[model samples]
Target: MPRYLDRDRLALLAALVAPLAVAVVLLTFRAGLPNTSIALILVVIVVAVAANGNRLAGGLAALSAAVWFDFFFTQPYQRFAVTKSVDIQTAVLLLVVGLAVSQLAARARRLQVVAITDADYLARIHDTAELAQSAKEPDTVVDHVTAQLTTLLHLRGCRFEYGSLIGHPPRLEPDGTVVWGRKRWDVDRLGLPNREIELRTFGNGRFYGRFMLDPTPGTIPPLQARLVAVTLADQTGAAFGTVGSG
Candidate 1:
């Protein structure tokens, strides 16, 4: 079995090297090929790299392609300086066009990933709603939501604390923000705290209980996942309200 480089590392390495390698091959025909055509070829390479990697890799590939194009194909062959005005324009345009296309490619990839993730989140919410509607007891709904949150948020454990707002643990708010004591916690950077974090559940504006989440150390769930967790809690709240009244 052969081990391959991870996507990020491979993409970054290609970004730094692919342009130079391609430019060297084009050097054989530099005398006959128009500089504009060479620049367009480099732009294509940038787009490919961007589609496969992150924004930083895409941007680096664009810069690398432009630099190599200037060095190899422009006037005063093998020099970085461009003696002709037209050659200079071509080089600049190559960089600009490459950067633009790379950005678009990266954004398209991101949108594709987000679209898939959103579909999964919607399915979870829909399933939870169905369970809440048909469940015989509110506790069943709470237990189900507990399991969902545990998996969704990558929590070490999750349990419901009924009544009384107990201690001032960190709270995951409806808007997906985390608050610890009086200040906002930076979940993206710091990850969730080691202690149990609370997500309160409400039924018809009445506080029912809280789900205390023990997060896996260094696990930082994305904002979308956090928002989905909040929605699931709300569904549990509705179930509680319905069962309590009945």
Candidate 2:
């Protein structure tokens, strides 16, 4: 999610604007349109807002529409006071319908996002397995690992650390370390923003090496990063085993 305002926040603002726009257009012919017809039209606008936004946004839109309708369309115009029971019914119905529609739309959007995420994860898993299979040598395996990780974690760059301790990879830490090249990775130092990470590769019950990575900002949450790190370590461990076995 963005640090600034998102679609939902904007929707709230839109809800406020929709009524004023509608009031301008509809009030022009307020004398010609029946109260019931105008009420139904306002309800339609509220429903649309709710469908495109969250529950709170929808509720706000409905309330605004009802308030405007009462002021401009009902008797005792330009006032908060309502005279007819029918007008009361109209406002209540509009608000109730808007809230209901917003709830349904919000649920649908959440499910849709989940479905897409699931599909993408499956694809990534398949690719990881395929890359692991094709890698025969340690360098090739390490290269593949780095590339896959860079893409998976939305990293800026990732490179394998091959040294004498290649067979003694570091243990996984709850708080992962960050690295970028030989110099310490820092936006202030590198003149740009980056999330650098260091993850060890342990395969076939022995350590292979570690990969230094710089991730894209705000892509993976802590829990998800740990999950990805574990998977990568498992794959790397398997590849290390294969290199020796071959």
Candidate 3:
């Protein structure tokens, strides 16, 4: 079960159990501590859970905290019923605040991931550009771009063809659109079509060659990554043009 359990499942389990454990520990001092204070403590727990997990995990933590608070700290102790209206308000706020905080935390996490990804994409482009500028042989640039595309697009393999192919395999356009058999394939929803996707390279308005990409099964690279791959191919094209002119 542990091997099968993913990160999300582990987070959800912690969300469901942490509040209950904390509530049980607080039960010892229930006679002295105010219910409001206990609710505050549970809110802290919910925030902690949300920070480490997703929105759903945060919400479950909040819900669990409220349930346990009602069961252990309310007027009718050891029961779910809450006799005081004040206790009811506290429970409701716990859920509401917990949910709101969870949403904010989730958004922050997403933004952080985007920032890291953007930085990495920039680095890949920068490195490839430098290599293209310094390398004398076009094969060097082609080989570098091929390796980069395989990793960037999560491809099984990538190879460079010296000239344009005769048949119309799916083409990855400059604008990062995938054209397959007279239709623009929805790479986002359907993943890359299970074929050798062609990413053509051009030098000074002339077609030099293409990079034939064999994507892994069910690999759906994001639009940003696809664009980076195109940019890398453009760098390769520029390198070919330089070598030809020289």
Candidate 1 stretches with Cα past 4 Å from truth are: 1-117
Candidate 3: residue 204 lDDT (0-100):
83
TM-score of each: 0.53, 0.42, 0.52
Count of clashes, each model: 0, 2, 0
The sequence of per-residue lDDT tens digits that candidate 2 reaches over residues 147-244 is 77777666778787753243322233422223334333333233323434557766666766677766566454333343444455556666677766
- Predicted structure 3, TM vs. truth: 0.52
What is each predicted model's overall lDDT from 0 to 1? Answer: 0.79, 0.59, 0.77
Q: Whole-model lDDT for model 3 versus the true structure?
A: 0.77
**CA lDDT, candidate 1, residue 200:** 94
- Per residue, candidate 3 scores C-alpha lDDT tens digits across 190-234 of 999898999999888878889999989988998667767877887
Weakest lDDT window of 10 consecutive positions for candidate 2: 113-122
Error of 1 at 57 (Å): 38
Q: Using alpha carbons, what is the TM-score of model 1?
A: 0.53
Say which prediction, candidate 1 or candidate 2, comes out ahead on TM-score: 1
lDDT: which is higher, 1 or 3?
1
Once model 1 is optimally superposed onto the true structure by TM-score, how far is the C-alpha of residue 166 displaced, in angstroms? 0.8
